[model samples]
Target: MSVRQTPLTCHGHTRPVVHLAFSGITDKGYYVMSACKDGKPMLRYGDTGDWIGTFEGHKGAVWGVALNYDGTRAATGAADFSAKIWDARSGHEEHAFQHNHIVKSVAFNPQGNLLVTGSNEKIIRIFDLQRPDAEPAKMMGHESNLRHCEFYTENIIVSCSDDKTIRLWDVTSAQEIRKLEFPNIVSDIEVSTQNRLLTLTHGNTVAFWNLDNLSLIKEFEVPTQIHSASLKPDKSIFVCGGEDFKLYKYDFDTGIELEAFKGHFGPVHCVRFSPDAELYASGSEDGTLRLWQTTVGKNYGLWKCVQAPSDLDKPGDAEG
Candidate 1:
């Protein structure tokens, strides 16, 4: 028997939701951010999807948004050819970094001191948050529009593009360290917290790679083209959504489909797991963000500390 668990819907954006990010868990709980074509990026409670506030300064459709480790700051890239940093607590703009073409992705280093922005110009730029007026460190190589990028280490980053490849680079040296080619255009990429495993979607396939040595670990073929996917921090489970308009969860080690459910009316564009590994959020073309618990009908956050009974408490006790 199963308990019918429903996702909490977050609404407000008038356009399609493109990207989503979750802040590391904190004393106040984790926060979620969403970027949409409506030109507004919003903050919400990670588990509940309750609206907190909106960061409202972008002049064009916002394509990507990320929250710093502690959720104190946020960075967003937009179709306006610029990226902006905001004080997450107050929803106030802090700095605006300009680009030559539409900005597609934005990410913050683990330390929260550096920001990386990828754009339609096929360039990746790293900006120092401490010195907003200074020139950003730039790197080049992607032949097509950028899709996503994330810091693999303090000095290294992995980025995917529509050119059907992924490249690893040294931010300090501004040189490519490794490149992995794919058969089709890569749509999205997600890395584990330890940066050891990465999962990506291209065409109708979802593949995993070893981030440490740059090797393909495994691949899973899905029925439809996936737009986004995320692996649980422990690498035990993964979830994906896309053209099928369904959310599919799988066991990473065995490649077994655990759950497949219909949710959004439109295709899902992005999905991310929370830091605590308890829940995940999905953004879709339906213009809303939905939150799902890792274990249906289970409240891990509240009952995680409760202890189970001893053997003596069982009906057939050993001592008896």
Candidate 2:
């Protein structure tokens, strides 16, 4: 018989959790940041789901959140028409980049020296952290509201929109590099620098692309309308959640469904794998975030095993 895997549920946000991001492993362990409709963004311990602090200056719903590579800083995009950077350790607002319209997405480059934002105005802007007061470089082309944006490299950016397209831009030249058209609005996108893969979900399909060449590698048709999906660090498997209020896991190579379970009481908006890939976290319209293990029955982080008396007497039990 298979053991039922239970997830670690985190609750605090009074409104729907819209986005979730995990920082790379740092000296203090990695961290998880969440954006919510309550106008507050939160940072928490990644492994244990323990609340760390909340950044509280946004006057409107926070639509996007991101943590820098080392987890020292955080950035948030909000309905207040601004993107603010905060000290991850101190929880104090460092700087705010004002926008003409609501900002929908924010991301920090690998070096943490720059920030990229996408707004309702269908424009993308890059802010130089070293010179916060300097005018940001702007890139424009998207025909509709921007859904998500992120740094593809130090000099390249990728953005998706409600216009039913994904676009790439060159930061130095402020020019559009390439654009890919889709039949439906792209809901979520994940750029994996380590795996050299780009994962995208739109409608009921999930597509993977070669990060270097932007060529289609493969695509999978999911049973439900997925809002978000994430590839494991090794690219062996993936997980997604959607309007069905169920989390689904699949084998990456063959596109075979591995598991499907319902946990959230409402639609899930975002899902992301931890930097270590031991677990994946999901945020929902139910106003909660949940962390699920990638491998069931394995002792990892806050998830532990309770051995029975018979198992405790096994030959390898002591070593374990």
Candidate 3:
């Protein structure tokens, strides 16, 4: 037997992995970056699951991780009231950021020169990576815990929080430019490579927002609370997962649930799309990372791997 699905195991930490990201390809498609409650981040080759390097600097749990568009650098947010920039390949510290509260999320701007971070303190701060010691411009509008955010352009960034609102920030002014209120608290936000916005909130609803005007485009109701989402490099499609344990894909224009993947034994905590958008990776409270292939129709035999799927076939490996 071919064993059904391919699998790869990464087991260095004792705690659960909360977030994972693909560097868009600087490591020759071999490295996958991950963060955990243990207050550290690990980089390993996706093909062999060989631990390449480690990043250690946070006093509390590292809650979020993000890579620049170029894949040369990475950013991490921790409960220690700060977010830091690191050299993706060397694991060297680039900059340290101080925020109002425990940092919950961090994202690099679409241009890759600026960084945005959100926190329980209810504010988002914008930092210019070139100036490591300069004060960051603050964005204040969210009233509750701001969990995560994404940048739409060099000047605009959107953030969501428990306050039930999404606010847009202007990098130059480092202030709130606009706001959109949701029915419930937002747990995560993703901006598509094409500039469309998707946010997963307190309920099962995933609302698509238009960044140009900050208007609602569409929404699909899920069966459980959503935790995270990933936008394909194009604006046409995206995927999200939640405590409901269901993974969903939908059309950006119609809000139709096109297909789904269900097999994880625990709540899904995070989801991400690869640089090319052909593949995605997810981690959960259940202690596993699931990888899937997405297209217009159902995901067939392309791949479906947990903990690094070593079974079906490797990305560049030929079929047996």
Candidate 4:
């Protein structure tokens, strides 16, 4: 038997959703944040598609959104040429850091005291949340606009750019440690809890690398160009969505497409699994987000219900 899950659509944004991020699970619940061209970032329940609150302030489209470990704080990067921090509980703006160009990506360190942002200026800046007025540590090397970045460790960060490369940097010295060049322009990158780096490139392919050594691990070619992909915490499966307007699930080890389903009306821009491994959220060009379960409709518990066959087709009975 096959289980086909239905997705719950979340509506509110008036423009295309460019990014989606899930906060680390807590006793309360996990939160999902979305960045959109509408200039507003929204917070929601990670498991369900229910609305929580919207962080409104950016005058231009927000390209990036990230939540801290506890989901109490959030950071957003926008075309307004700035990155702003927010108190997620109150939905209030905390601090706004100015940039030389449009901010494209934003992330927070594990400690939650540092915020890293990559921008169209081809530079990555790390800001001390405790000192908003101080100058941020800058690392520059990308030949094109920066797209995505995340903390690989306490003292290191990984970044991907449109220049067809991913670079690793040391936080303290702001120096590039290593770089991995890809044949196609990298569009998005994600770091799993198991310390695996997954990247989606413009060539309709998905690649994985060892986060510690930045060495090539595996790559899979998809039928369509995937804008974003995320690996399951257990490394059993991965889900991706893109130009096909459908979500595709693949076996992580074999790279075989396990299942595919239509959930959005437009191209999906980003997809991320919940920290609890219960569900995943997808943001699309249709200006909405959808939530899907990790196991479709079947429960993975010890016991499962079985159905008995009817007598109608039990024997080779002749047709009337």
Which residues of candidate 1, in runs, are more than 4 Å off? 300-320
Ranking by lDDT: 2, 1, 4, 3
For each candidate, the alpha-carbon lDDT, in order, equals 0.87, 0.91, 0.71, 0.85
Q: Estimate each model's TM-score.
A: 0.92, 0.95, 0.82, 0.91
Q: How well does candidate 1 score on lDDT at residue 78?
A: 98
lDDT of 1 by residue, 1-320 (tens): 33543566777888899999999888899999999999999998786677889998889999999999889999999999999999999999999999999999999988999999999999999999999899999889999999898997889899999999999999899899999999999999887758588889999889999998888899999888999999998889999999988888999999999998787889989998888888888989998888777887575532222224332221211110
Candidate 2 residue lDDT tens string, 1-320: 34555677888889999999999998889999989999999899998788889898999999999999899999999999999999999999999999999999999998999999999999999999999999999999999999999998899899999999999899999999999999999999999888888899999999999878889999999999999999998889999999999999999999999999887999999999999999899999998888888886577876765345334322211000
Clashing pairs in 1: none
Q: Report the lDDT of model 1 for residue 112.
A: 93
Error of 1 at 102 (Å): 0.3
Clash counts for all predictions: 0, 0, 10, 0
Model 1 collision count: 0
Better of 1 and 3 by TM-score: 1
Encode model 4's per-residue lDDT on 1-320: one tens digit a residue.
43355666778899999998888878878888999999989998776666889998999999999999889999999999999999999999999999999999999988899999999999999999999899999999999999998887779898999899989999999999999888888888887636556555556888887787667788888889889888888888888889999999999899999989996989999998888887788999999887777875544311122234322222121110
Q: Looking at candidate 4, what is the lDDT of residue 196?
A: 57
Best by TM-score: 2
Q: Which residue ranges in model 3 land beyond 4 Å of their true spot?
A: 1-9, 45-50, 234-237, 250-259, 295-320
